[model samples]
Target: MPLPRPLAPTGRVAVVAPASAPLDPADAHAGLSVLRERGLRVETADPAGGPAAYLAGTDDARVAALNAALARDDLDALVCVRGGYGVLRILDRVDYAAARAHPKLVVGYSDVTALHLALWKEAGLPGVSGPMVASDWGVGLDAETEADFWRVVGGDAGYDVRGPGGEALTPLAPGEAEGVLLGGNLALVTALLGTPFLPDLTGAILFVEDVGEAPYRIDGMLARLRLAGVLGRLGGLVFGMFTGADVAPGRPTFSVDEVLAHYAPSVGGPVASGLVYGHVPRKSTLPVGVRARLTCGAEARLHVLDPVAA
Candidate 1:
């Protein structure tokens, strides 16, 4: 894990729209208010980059905004406006040299997971797999979610993450382990499997989550990971809510739990599910590539060893 780059109060953080354009421009504007309320100077591109198809802008435009954000020394962090798709198209074009020279916090989840995998491999750069501006910030963040979001991204380190209601993590397989915390959206992770961007999770406490992916689709991706020897490299396995992945009543399909039964054991270490870490309204802020310890007990707890910012 890299050393922390803690963001001081009132530090500047740029907002970049690297994925799809915002569904609601109102949300983007409100999201800006949310950040300003945190006492930070916020900068953003014309997030209204006049949609070029489904993307916020043409491939080159999105890449330019992100790379430009990295090149600036004034910014303490970078946050994505939203995530839909299109990151892979610009992955190869993003030059991380400038980011590597002066590392700053990068934040997003879902499609941005691909960016996390790429940046972590290219520059050992760390990012927040947590709330996004339009995604959570504009979705009416609750007291607890807002508090947790600031604590994690505000440069606090070594805090424990647990399931909803502060419940113990329920293990599918029992044990304890510790390693760099890595992983994000399952679909994005699956898409990067054979690519150079995939981080080598040799001793990683790997975690994954997704939304609307059916049971068989999840199973197929997990199977691919197992065959690629991805699962065997994990120090532990953590699964967040598989929102909307459930099969409908009377449908002849395997349950999400059933899919896990086939692959969780391949992890060669502890495995826990129902972790509140993805695709939900109340999302946890995860610092990519940070050292963390996972203890699977009657309650499972993960403690991030490094702060997100310097």
Candidate 2:
């Protein structure tokens, strides 16, 4: 199946909340302002601001808002407001059929990883594993992250992403792997292992990252992937920024390096070193199911192999 094409900057963008509680109007406005400055027109549906506990709204309500947006011929794409716990609650409730038939650039990370995987599995349309409208852009994505977002959205043919200026990549395995890039939050990817939404990783470079998870927790999650045969199936692996800010006040019992080494061999493929994407500021954007080339040795590099939709 062909990947979903990205919308041009002037196209109308739909802001919705498949997850997260309610959004603060102030934050939403700030984010939309940034998009507007970039030449995009963003509009919100009624449920975009509605609240139902920790979700934007009720399962049915959220689904309705999303479906309504997807059904619109005028909306060029949908951008999630935030990624919280509730998206999984309404995972099955989305009308992916119409949306897939009329592919739109769906964006978000973290909880939104669920949506990304679903869209790829059910619709065969690739979506951005990037920032959400409310948090990423509003909270101030570092200059690098902001640039990476436009690069992916503009469908830059292929490009390389390096670690932040002085930051160094910690190599896990030495070599290179080329194939479609697939994966998001380590926790989310592991959570869906036995589920239907998990993508086929036969020859894909898997990338994962997360926020607030303890190193031990990261270890456990990677272990689950190994047990579920996820690691063993990848063509390669890319470890993203595991934000330590969310870890409790104590020293981590395990380091990310240890966790990567433990599972690197199980993947039966090359494992690229540290990648600066995920729960950190200035995160790099990646299309969940797009193809890419990952080289790891003395230095590390991720070269997108497939063209992002334009």
Best TM-score among the predictions, by candidate number = 1
* Candidate 1 error regions (>4 Å): 1-4, 47-49
Question: Worst lDDT window (10 residues) for model 2?
Answer: 161-170
Give lDDT tens digits, candidate 1, residues 223-250: 9899999899899988887888977789
Q: Write the per-residue lDDT of candidate 2 for residues 1-310, one digit (tens) a residue.
A: 5455666778788888888743576777788788888788988864744687777887888888888887776766788888877777776777878777777778888888888887788777788888888787776677767777777876775777665453445667777889888888888888787777777878889888888887788888988888877787788898888886244566656576777788888887778666878877666788777778877787777788776575
lDDT of each: 0.83, 0.77
